[model samples]
Target: MQKLQFEALRRIGLTLAVAQELIHLLEQHPGCIPVRVTEVHRETVRLDDGTQDLPARRMPSLARGLADQDDAVAVGDWGLARCDAHGDWWLTHCLQPFSALVRRDGDGLRHIVVSNVDTALLVMGLDLDFSLRRIERFLALVQASGVRPVVVLSKPDLCADMPRALAQLQARLPADVPHVVLDGRNAAAAEVLAPWLAPAQTLVLLGSSGAGKSTLANTLMGHAVQETGATREGDGRGRHTTTSRSLHRLPGGACLIDTPGVRTLRPDASEASLAASFNDVARLSLQCRFRDCQHRGEPGCAVREGVDGDRLNNFHKLQREMRRDTLTALERRQQLSEWKARGRAGRANLRAKRGE
Candidate 1:
């Protein structure tokens, strides 16, 4: 048996901890090969063993015994593969991911965007696609995923007033959340993002279409690895160029995953998770008089007094969405009457606060 280069595996973002985990799993299942899932499709998945792109499917028995979608193959997942007598490979078991980017869809089920991510490049074009609210949403999702976030404000050259735009973004965000304003098409991205893109690190680009994610991915990769598309002239919204989440080796030994443009990201996170993203608000809430204060008409509500009104509204809006998502369809239907009443009451409270 030929020995394997664990260094080759590290080039694909495999850390020493994961290597030991793979070794332990392989110890139990002899003759099984460890492969990283780079691309997952409807029927088949693409595997990378640090040597070649081996297209593989799940073993029939393994496929039948799948617990849920999480057990299904996905990019950034490490899987154990075994070759049959005919020499065809089949992915048998998926190893646990150290970190994962996940969100809840309208169905309220967790959708794992990408697994084993070290850093997330939260891209936002300085063009019409820019919004602080959207950035806040991404922050919640990233924080919940336990992945560090670096806000990449793409296409600075396109902004009419770069300083004003930057100031507005910096106002809402914390001072500690590092943000970089750059033209993603140029070579400067590799330098500006160097802190997170060191060798053996794995970074994922996350943003809406037309946010210059694919362009940055190509720039960092030192080639046109991911296809770039232009945003519409009207709204500056981009088309879906990268249709799936796929990982590729970068020029500097780190790996990058280019995900399809997301129209919306509903964080499948708890209120504490939401508060982690909005630390300023959370800190203010600690000063509130009541322990369970909702910040509406409550005395000594620091959140109402200190926090910006627009941010407060946004926080409440997301909280309502999360609460609604937790309810089942039947429960939602049953509560539709009281839900409308609460909406009316909430609006009345808002109006009262404004009139105050």
Candidate 2:
């Protein structure tokens, strides 16, 4: 009976490693059963026991024990649940996800977008909503999470210059990263993205609002599973059609998670991850004369000479943002004081030189 149950869970994206982990967990908690989180609400989560969906709340102690609020729970998390005397299911233990897509907000809070996802469909509209910089940012975040990223250029039918757009993408993105152009509403989308939709695979659609993520999700699911909305005429930006993140079982046996469009995506990545994302700039930096070259008009700066000015500048910006996020409260205050002191000293020198 347990083997049958395990088989059912495997059909819903349970890997061998996770299954082994689950077996250990089951031994430790004989009263608890394994459940996969499908949707997470404010106070309750929707869990699947491979047969039925159950609305379960976290145990009070479980919620209180978590150090970070983001670690509480999220869609795609595999956990242990138990039914109480009142016939209500309660999630007691959350299994550590092998891969998690995380983003840090401006307030320095980490938000786990999705857990245990194998691939990220980095959806971007080919219309005015397209931007190479935004694609780079998404790529960085996906790579940081150790999830494979496939660039999906959505709404190809709506694009006026498909060739030019494709050319731009090929020129900017890494050659190894796969990208495909497809109209999400067309049935052909399934065929185009078939390579990544194999059984037991899990994927997440990530893009801004109006990027055709829902449309793609519906097409891939072979039904209207998610709602679609039109883009604004003035800006070509999408409306918030998907208000929450939810997982759906694809006919091909893979699991798909559709997320609400993010307004701000500050990647929760370290300096090493950022460097890996900007491989060209990082490689060039190694050849620079100074080990600590800022590449801002510095002598023998290979990065400044070799990389595109805009691309290099974006790398620098993201690097600074990553460093700033790692700083402590005291470190931030000291950095601010140093900046103020430098400003004051520079102003004084200018005044003296001007004979003030």
Candidate 3:
């Protein structure tokens, strides 16, 4: 069946295997139907392409799987959906993600915002929203996703003290990662992003709303494909402009997925990602007297002695957050196991009552 599907897809002009993977992913949903993703909206995904066999159709599907839901793949993910002969569409399953930016949602579930991305552009406006701690959160999430993360500081014109802001950013970020502070509204700035914007690569723009993600995306695509809005004056926060997760193909052969503004991001991180994100801290900690030194009031603690008190304090804060995330995940897992065990016990009691 898979071979035939591939052969059929080949007959059409769509030479990519991505759509096929998407179809397979959605097939896991028992009642889903195959639909081609032409465009996506905040609530519904527009499906009407030559690849789809259904009658010229555009129907509403649940955004539930796309939001704050565990095992739910985000935009840029291909899945097999169950949309029957009646034109109803239900997402059945998601394809295995090559890469994704995931964070813990309100329900304590891992939410995938963007998936199968080659690059994650961590957008931060050079204006008020710029903070090293916030950037660290994003870096933690990106590191957890196992994808390359590039930082782009937007709205350079708004910053009165550009040098100071840049200094702070530079101080927190490692020397190896690429970081750019650019005017999202400018064409020349788009050219500076050309290397990652090359053909065939897929990148996602992520930041708080009004960070100029949509603006940067539009500039790169050489067209106003997304809506743009001014930043809020009341608190210097950005109003939600790009309310949907949508994918666009650039003339340069790259693809970009613009996502809604994320207000709060929980670090659903792994130990490896935490270590990688805070490698400096890790390196310093290794020099401590005890192998398991907590670096707090421990005699001959090299980490405590060598690093600045403020910098060490920040590292410890990040460490505490990482540990908290791990504990939370463990607690959730334990509760789930307990619930399942109770269910099993109840089933056993019922079976015995039935005289097995």
Top-lDDT structure, candidate number: 2
- Name the better of 1 and 2 by lDDT: 2
Cα lDDT, all candidates: 0.85, 0.88, 0.69
Error of 2 at 244 (Å): 1.0
Every model: Cα RMSD to truth:
4.4, 2.5, 11.3
* Steric overlap count per candidate: 0, 1, 17
- Poorest 10 consecutive residues of model 3 by lDDT? 53-62
What's the best-to-worst order under lDDT? 2, 1, 3
Q: Runs in model 2 with CA error above 4 Å?
A: 1-4, 68-70, 338-356
The sequence of per-residue lDDT tens digits that candidate 1 reaches over residues 1-356 is: 22345988888888888887888888778778788989988878888888888888887776676645445556798868877898787898888888988888777777788999899999999889988889988988898888999999998888899989988888788677899988898998888888888888989999999899999988888889778888899889999988999999998889999999986879877888888877888898889999999998988898999877877787887888788778988988878888799999999999999995
Better of 1 and 3 by lDDT: 1
Give the per-residue lDDT of model 3 (tens digit) for 20-129: 55455444443453333434444455442224533222223334443434354356654455556775665544456677787875554666677777888999988878
Which model is ahead, 1 or 2, in terms of TM-score?
Answer: 2
TM-score of 3: 0.73
lDDT tens per residue, model 2, 1-356: 13327768876788887888888888888888888999999899899887788999988888887655547688999878999999999999988999999988776678899999999999999887898888989988999999999999998778898889898888778767899989999999999999999998999999999999999999988899888989999989999999999988898889999999964588988988888888888888899999999889889999888888887777887788788888888998999999999999999999999999
Off by over 4 Å in 1: 1-4, 68-71, 328-330, 340-356
Which candidate ranks first by TM-score, i.e. highest? 2
